[model samples]
Structures are given as C-alpha cells and as structure tokens.
Target chain A: EPEVTQTPSHQVTQMGQEVILRCVPISNHLYFYWYRQILGQKVEFLVSFYNNEISEKSEIFDDQFSVERPDGSNFTLKIRSTKLEDSAMYFCASRPPGLATFTGELFFGEGSRLTVL
Target chain B: EDQVTQSPEALRLQEGESSSLNCSYTVSGLRGLFWYRQDPGKGPEFLFTLYSAGEEKEKERLKATLTKKESFLHITAPKPEDSATYLCAVLVAGGGADGLTFGKGTHLIIQP
Candidate 1:
C-alpha cells in the first residue's frame, strides 16, 4: 500500500534557528495534516491543509509555524524560530476526505524527530 | 470541550493471555472513533475505524468495539509482537480542524 513519506527522520538544531520538515503525502490524498507528540504525551494536532490553503490550525501552531505545499508532491512545515518545547516527533498525515469509504481514514508517515539544543 | 481518555497506562500480558484496553470520550456529535498501534520511536499505524455504536471490526488477533461513549480494543492469545502502545482518538463533528482528539495511549508488553 502507498504511504506518506517524510524526510530527515531525526534533526538536531540550535534554539532560535529555522527548520523545515518535509513530507510527501500519498499521491491521491486531498487533505493533509501535521501533528506532534511530546515524549510520553498524547499526539496533538498542529495544522490541516486542503485546496492549497490552511484549513485550520491549533494554538500550538502559532506565529513561528507555517505550512506550505511548495509543489505538487511536497508538503513542508517550517518553524521560524525553534524552542526547547518544540522538540518532539512531528507526523504528517493525509486522506482522501469526502468519500464515503475514505472518510476518517488517515494515512500517516513515519514521522520526523526534532531535537532542539 | 472534547476529550479522549484511555485506561491502564501500561499492561503486561503473557503469551496466550487475553485482555482488553479501554478508551472513553466525551464529545458532541462523534463523527468517528479510531484505533492505532505505535511501536517505540515510530508513528502510529491505523487499525480500525468505528462510525457508530455497536459497530465492531477485527484483524488478526485484535478486535475493536465501539459504543456511544467508549471503545474497547481486545487482544486474544497475544504474542510478544503485540507489545506496543494502543491509541484511541475521536473525530467530533465541528470540534475543530482535522477533527481528532487522541488519548495518551495504553502501553502493552506481552512476554513470551
């Protein structure tokens, strides 16, 4: 089965530096999302994208965070200034929403682990 | 406010043992309920989707059952490979963007 794929499985960056995490969602998926999991914590939603614009975002997705579909296949999450609290596993997910059978079924990528120093 | 709560923060089962994990939620207009499995250092893998009360789905030795306010994941004759964190999430209609709120998860360790 086709799955979402992310690059840079692990990243270590200095606090205050900019970082961009990349994801290639399933080719045919129409809705894209980003989530984060702090160590030993529940996964938290970050943002959702569709039709080339941000559909919604959580409070955690504040001024420092942004997402873009720079091209047909790549969905990127950019953090303008990293913080210690930002260190976590970031996941990318996609789904073909609106279809009867596909509703609520999200395919997720392996995730990118970010460590801020 | 919408929330997903899972019980038994951790579990230990011997090979061939059977057990059930619980997930309780309080949300308005539940669109769907989902179950996922997560191994250490990896993202969650989708398992089942339950759309209504009294619905059930199964795969291999795992079964997921849903109701109006809770869901259960039952594992029968579990093996060491069944050791992982089980996560439950709820998609509430008009709750927020992307429609999901997940529990902290239940960590299961099956011993051989």
Candidate 2:
C-alpha cells in the first residue's frame, strides 16, 4: 500500500529560527493537508492544498505559516519563526481523487516531531 | 464550529473482552464521520468512514456505526494487539478546504 512519507522525522530548532517540514504524498492523490497535535491535545488542522493553491486554513495557520507544493511530489510547510508553543507533531495527509467527497479517510505520514527551544 | 467529543478518556480490558467507544459530535451539516487508530510515535491509521446516519462498517473484530448525533466503535473479542488510541473526527458540509475536526481520542489498553 502506498503511504505518505515525511522527511526529518525529528527536528529541534531555536526560537525565532525557520523550519520547513517536507512530505511526499501518495503519487496519485489530488488533495493534501497539514495537521498538528500538541502534547496531550487533539489533532488540529492547519491548511489544505489543492491545484497548487491553498483551499482553507485555520487561525492556527497564521502569518508565520505557509505551505507549498514546489514539485509534483513534494508538499512542505514552513514556519518563519518558531516559538516554544510551536512544538508539536506535524502530520501530512492526502486523499485520492474520486473519493475526496465520498469519505473522510485520509492517508497520513508517520509525522515530523518539531521541538522549539 | 464543529466539535467532536469522545467518551471515556481511557479504557482497559482483558483479552477477549468486548466494549464500545463513543463519539458525540455537533456540526452544521454532516459530510462524513471517520475513525482512526494511532499508536505512540505514529500518525493516525484510517479505519472506517461513515457517510450518513444509519451507516455501518466493519473490519475484523472492529465495527463502527453512525447515527444522527453520535457514532460508536465497537470492539468484539479484542486482543492485546488491539491496544491503541482511537480517534474520531467530523467533516462538516461546506467546510471548504479545512480538514477534519478531531476529538481528544480514547486510549484503549487490552491486556492478556
């Protein structure tokens, strides 16, 4: 079974530094998303990307956060300046084309753990 | 705002025991309800998608049922390997590009 793959399984960055988490979603999928889970918190949506554009974003995805699909296979989330509160596990997910509207079953990567200090 | 509440923050059962996990949701228009299983240090693994009220899906020893206001994940004859955090989420109609809104999740432990 094909799965979403994320790079840099764990990252530790200084406060005010920049970090970019990368993901390679399933090849044939059309929609991609980013979500994060703070320690002991529920998963929160960040943004969704489709057709090289952002479809929707949350308040948590503020000015400092951005996402890009620079290539056919890579989806990335960049934070301009990391904060202590930014520490969390970031997940990348993708959904197949035809099933996008029929179900909410998203295939997720193992996740990238970010630690800001 | 769409909200999902999962009951019984944690549960422990002996092997071969059976139980159910509850997910109560409040959303404007229900698009879909999903159930996922997550282990430590891993992302969520999709298990079932219930699109409408009265819909149900099953896999192995797991069965998921949906109603107008809530959903239930029933585990029958569970084993130690079934231990994991079960997450429930909701997709509301016209939710745009936003992804699913998740609950806090229920931690399940099955002991032999």
Most accurate candidate by DockQ:
2
Q: What DockQ, on C-alphas, does every prediction get?
A: 0.65, 0.79
Q: Once superposed on the true structure, which residue ranges of model 1 sit more than 4 Å away at CA?
A: A97-102
| Candidate 1, residue A14: how far the Cα is off, in Å | 1.3
**Which tens-of-lDDT digit does each residue in B1-112 have in candidate 1?**
8989999999999999999999999997788899999999787888999999999999999999998889999999999999999999988776444646899999999999
How far is A4's C-alpha from truth in model 1 (Å)? 1.4
RMSD of 2: 1.1
Which ten residues in a row are the worst by lDDT in model 2 chain A?
A: A96-105
Q: What is the lDDT of residue A96 in candidate 2?
A: 86
TM-score, candidate 1, is 0.95
> What proportion of true contacts does candidate 1 retain?
0.63
Q: Which stretches of candidate 2 lie over 4 Å from their true place?
A: none
